[model samples]
Target: MRRSRLSTRGLTEGAIQAALVAVLALLTRYVPLAVLATTFLMPLPLMVLTIRHGVRPAVLAAVVSGVVAGMLSGDLLTGVGILVAVAPFGIMVGWGTRRGWSGPAIVGMAVLVSGASLVVNGLLLLAFLGINPVQQYGEMVLTMRQQMDTAASLYGRLGLGQEAAESYRRTMLAVLDLMPRLVLFGFVATAVTTGWLNYEIARPILRRVGHPLPALPPASTWRVPGFALWLLPLAWLISALGWQPVTTLSDRLRSSLPPAPLPVPSDLGLNLLALLSVALLVQGVIVGWVFLGRYRLHRALRVLLLLWLTFNPIFSNLLLIVGLVDSIFPLRERLGRRAAPAEVKP
Candidate 1:
């Protein structure tokens, strides 16, 4: 009898959540302005359901919601695509909330999910488009190079000279050389951001609705794992290897079995460097936020500083150094000891 009631309750909650997810999906799909909103709202129902019930029920609910959404939208592709993109992050976050996990742990899981989904996206692109992104990028570059050559010939005839055209092309290629890694890191960083945003949004709403998650630790105390300091050297080492030696080493290490149908990123070093940079960058941002409160900087100054940190050309390397230093030594704790009594810690 007790088992029956448990099953019934799970079903009831799952049905309600599944309906909500479907409604959000349809609403976000049809309402053009609500397009950006799918990211926040679509996963929310599943997340809340997972928190209240468990992962199993949440998975079931996701499938049902996807089906209902597909039917309502008259297209299964949109439903499935959005579900794959957003559901894992939500479900993992929900599980973390249920288990009393920290903010970073939850976000880490979201990163993994988001990264794996990139592989799925690549596969889909290959299946439908007959070429993956890396291949498409190479083709695009080649086409652009040909166009530049033709343009340079015209420039030379016009007395403008080919030097300017060649230089422009070189500059563009150099900036786009590390695109694969940039794309991957972009997804990773976005997953982290969305994971954090969901938790921040969910915490107060859940508490008021009587499904409060464990409270987040103070942001001033936000510290990456001690071992994360190694990422700097590891990234640098991989980047130093570049593509040839790295690919050779990988080939030697890999088994003699046939390669998978999917494409592998040739610029392995750049990918690792980019991925590691994202981790370091997050730590640096937190360090900045913590210090902002530690010194009681003026609100206007804080805003300007944040803008500079985000937009400055030197921000990447600067933040990378700060993150690595903070990871190796307790810079926050050390500096925090001297903070004034009136200053509020983040």
Candidate 2:
């Protein structure tokens, strides 16, 4: 693929856009918009520059935005965090533009930005606060227990069975045991919300800040593809109906079978394997959507998140099924397009 060559004029425009993005990033911290800006806001300028002048300008802008945002966040480490978060957008957008896969390119950029930002921010917090990982882990377990109890109480109030209560507890424990997996899942959520808002909220604000890109598409153009949107719920539904019975069967077998000594919950080896499986499964679905569905990048991301939330232990089987059912429209559209056309009359 030929690269989108940047002219001197393009470079000038990119610098202006980058500055605008940085200012917007700074403002988001002060006036809380309906949008969570950190993940989405910081990337818009980069995206704009990429769209306008290909990747070089986008990268230059990202570097500038990172510096500005770091300064505003008030720590040298935070500035580094900002760079880590935004630079991926530049790289992905550049690659995407070069290859002419605009949607995936943007989506890829968003994913990288969100994932990196989350990691950078998490680490920065730990570094600055002198947070104890061991204590935090214990506290996290307690928090999980509280959330599970709440789910259980909700189930009981809704007249669900002992099985429901048990599942809630088990699932919550599974969630905590899968912390690394959860962090990965969180990126999906961050990307969806961030992408939507970046296009809707941040772009206009950045434009007003005297930084505009060349012939930029409307941010909403970055909307999740309709098919991908539907795939999410479908994935959840399949997981719920498919997995719930299996879970129940496993539980029953574990309870009723001649009890071989049960495995210890604290077995790190087993826990690590479980985490790896969940991560791979979640990632597999994302990859599947990317290839199978004629959808945009945003939709692929949203679907991935839904699958993770559904199968990754955050919600019940019923909830997962509900999400799947909700995604039917896009699924229908996607499938319909792939169907062979009817034969012409002789």
Candidate 3:
């Protein structure tokens, strides 16, 4: 009799959570806060359900949410979008937390889910909806070019010489041209960032709800594995060696100094370079945090330092380099050891 009552209560709770998830999913389709809700808030209800009720209940809630969203939006595509864009992320994060995974490991899982969802959704759209994302991206680039051309006078009014303005336009166009080719990498990066942000937001809420949550290591103590540094050199070598023949051909064609052929780095090389840079940047930020705590830096100084590193490309690169060297050398560990006796002495 007691077991039956417990089972009944569990089902009731799951239904309530499912309804909440459905409501939030429906809200994501409306105006005003649509983009913000879809991007950041839509996953929270599912995440809350998963944390409170376990995987089975959470999965059921997600399916219910999708169906309700589809019915409300008057299209099955809404359900498909929820399944593709939101369900996997919430499920993975919740499962990872329940399984006691570290913050980085959970984040890695989220990235994989996000990237796979992007590919799957793209294929679905092309196969069923007759929409080619690549063609749409190309159209977007053309539109941007047209807008930039119309704004040439504004550039001139900003004191840019014709040559400088033209160079700026060319640079912007080049980035747009590259966007379609780098879509996969961009998706993965976005997923990784979003996963981290969501995890940070969810951690405190989960704790408050009586879920077992692991504490992340302090930023000063954080250390990425050292082998990531090897990718930097490998990426540079591949970039230099992969396109020699193309470079030679382009040089021959450009004897009259017309626009040179744009050199395209191998996708693998670009991915490796980008991933390594991000890892090192994270390590650098942790090292900075350690310094601030060890030396008791003022709050305002710390904020100013962060803003400077964020806005200044040169300083950012320097931080990345510092992070790379620290990965191999364990600079923070050494410094902490040296400071220990002084700290202990009164």
Candidate 4:
């Protein structure tokens, strides 16, 4: 009898949370503050339910939310979008936290799940709708280029020459060409970042509500595995050695085949480099945080340092290098040992 009552209460709570998620998902489509709502707010209720009730309730809430959202929007695709975009991420995060996974581990799992979900959704769309999304996006990019070309006269009046306008258009076209190839990596990065942000936001709320949450290690103590240091160099070597040969091979194949295959080596190398850079960037941020804490830096100064590191490309790259070196050298541990003697003297 007691188990039955507990189960009933769980269902009621799940339903309420599901309704909240549906409302937020609807708001994201039409709201003026769509970025803020979608990034931070919309995922909260579902995350809370997951934290409180575990995986089954969370999955149920996600399905119910999708259904409710579909009804409100009058488009079944909207429901699928919600399920694909939001649900798996929340579920992975909740499950990881419940199992006492570390911050990095949780984020890593969420990124993998998010990437897989994107691929699956893309496949589904291709199978049912006869639509190639990458091709569609590329076409949209071309359409934009045409529109910009039409506006070239306006640019000329604004003192920009035709040559400069044409150069800008080419740059944009190059970026668009790369976008489809990098979609999976980009999705993974987005998932990791947004999942981390949501976790930081939800942690305190979960604590307030008496839910158990895993403790994240301090930034000063964080360390990437040593094997990660080899990735960037390896990627560079592959690109340098294989790019020309692969391009020639791909061209020959393209001439022979009706449909051209993707340039695998180039795409893989670029994506691997990007992924390694992000990992190093994170390590760099953590190293900065550790230094700030060790020196007892003023709050304003710390904020300025962070802003500079984030905005200045040179500084960002320098930090990435520092992070890469530290991974192999244990720089923080050495620094700690040097600092240790001063405390003994005091």
Candidate 5:
């Protein structure tokens, strides 16, 4: 039985990996529009692949993403550069797993991956685009300002405070300080999602192939609100502990902000209300977790997560419809049995 299960698990993973690669390859045909409109989507699949299989597999997948992207866009160097940049996420995951690191450690690794990708991409762009390094860096600053402005505008509309708006803006740029690690975090998160999805999709197929399913980790009670709440304190704790250095860096960036008119509001009440609303929302999330046991909540959350990911860049409106259908139908749950509990070998 064990041997059969092992064989099945291998086949399932292999099949899923192949499917992902093939889909990504096909999607490459749309890279031109996708890249100019939204660069975020380009590296995402490669990042997901890296998270699941570690560096080697991620690199292999990236190679494929690169090839397809190159052919479709006629930008082989850029495609290959993106692949090279993203592949390290797999390495970070592999290194972390091998070391048996904690959640924060994994997060740190992700930060490294993001930073490296950003740096490598930036350098590559500068070298090939016939742009001076200083000019390129200045463009990055402008780009960041635009993103900050967008974030601030949204927050302001929501009645968020100047301090909070500023804080958030600072955080956005501050993330660049640990770009590689942040990217890695994104990759790792995506990886975990992929693993869960794989297990779900693979289990039934393996069983049909005369193999037992790979064991799955016990489900977490997934309350979206609750999960968000739990994450708040952890985020706060990290921020508080890391504030000094962050502030020092922020001061430098603030000095660099163009001496142009600020669009951010100065309303204290709006800001206060915004912050309070955010807090209450977080509190509600935590309370929901307590009220709802983890497992059922987790199931709903997982479905939502998968839907969002599959439709990422969110242009594939069909994926959203599919998500709604899956949420209503839940074929995965109804069809697949719970994986056998892993045995403790100690």
Candidate 6:
């Protein structure tokens, strides 16, 4: 009787969560304004189901939600899309939460699962729908290029100066050149962002339900692993040696022939630099936050100041330098509130 009761309760909860997911999916389909918020929140119900009832019921809930969503929308793929987008991410996060994983570890696992779902399911979805990703991407690039050219011309007419307009065109072209190479990284970044957002949204709700999620460690204590110090040099070596995994894979994927391989771009190094620069910029913000703490500024003020520094082109470069220096030396241990340097003789 006890086992039967537990099973019944689990099925009841799973059904309720599946209904919620279908409702959210319908809202996304019918309501335009709610998409930005609702799109991310769609995973929450199923996530809670996983946490409360476990994976088996969560899987059932996901299947029911997908079918209900498809049937309601009159297109089966829409249901598949909903499942592909939200299920893996939500389930992984719930699993991690149940296992008492740290915030970072949870997000890390969730991102990988989310990214894999996007790529693998995306391919199958496109195959099912007879859509060509390469052709779609090409059309997107063409439209963007045209818009950029128009903008550059408008800038020239607006007296932003010919030099400024030309520079802008060059910059935009560089970005366009990089887009294909960075698709994998873009997907990974999207996964990371979504995982973090889900974790944030679920934290308070979980606490309210008597299950508290782990919080992130303070920014000051956050350290890039020592091995990461070698990434910058690796980036340089990739540039020097022309080992273009990103570019080569990108080329092969877009190619019609299985054996076709494209020559490595001269600026394959730029791809590595672009990824590393973004990472270092994050580290730099952490370093800057630590330094700001020394002056005892309010937390809000420090965050605002960091934002300003990051957005300012000049200061942002300086921030990257600070991050690199901090990574190499124990800047936090040395500059923290306690522990003056031995030579300083405090």
In terms of lDDT, which candidate is strongest?
A: 6
Q: So what's the TM-score on candidate 1?
A: 0.71
Write down the lDDT of every candidate, Cα atoms only.
0.71, 0.55, 0.72, 0.74, 0.48, 0.79
The TM-score ranking, best first, is 6, 3, 4, 1, 2, 5
Q: Clash pairs of candidate 4?
A: none
lDDT of 6 by residue, 1-346 (tens): 9989988999999999999988898888889999887788788887788888788898899999999999999988768877788888888888888788898898788778877776877697578977766567767887898899899999999999999999989988887876866665566677778777777887887788777778877667776666776777766665666634343456557464433133454245555676678777888888878777787889999989999999887999998887777777887656656545679556
> For model 6, what is the error of residue 257's alpha carbon versus the real structure, in angstroms, after optimal superposition?
20
After the best TM-score superposition of candidate 4, give how far the Cα of residue 177 lies from its true spot, in angstroms: 7.6
Residue-by-residue lDDT tens digits, candidate 2, 30-134: 567723645555665565566556676677777776687677777565456546655565455445544666454455455556666666666866888887544
Q: Write the per-residue lDDT of candidate 1 for residues 1-346, one digit (tens) a residue.
A: 9988987898899999888888878877788898776657777777788888889998998888888888888887656765676677678878988898876677667667777766776777677567777677667766775676677677778887578767766766666565544665656666567656766776677778677766667766776777865665765665554333234546547555455333334355466677766666767777776677577888788768867886565885787778778888987666656535696779
**Per-candidate TM-score against the hidden true structure:** 0.71, 0.48, 0.78, 0.74, 0.34, 0.84
Q: Cα RMSD to native, each candidate?
A: 7.4, 11.5, 5.5, 5.3, 15.3, 5.1
Top-down lDDT ranking: 6, 4, 3, 1, 2, 5
lDDT (C-alpha) at residue 93 in model 4: 77
* TM-score, prediction 4: 0.74
| TM-score-superior candidate, 2 or 3 | 3
Q: What is the lDDT of candidate 1?
A: 0.71
Q: Which stretches of model 5 miss by more than 4 angstroms? A: 1-58, 132-134, 137-346
- Of candidate 6, the 10-residue stretch with the lowest lDDT total is 257-266
Provide the global lDDT of candidate 2 against the true structure: 0.55
How far does residue 252 in candidate 4 sit from its true spot (Å)?
6.3
Report the Cα lDDT for candidate 3.
Answer: 0.72
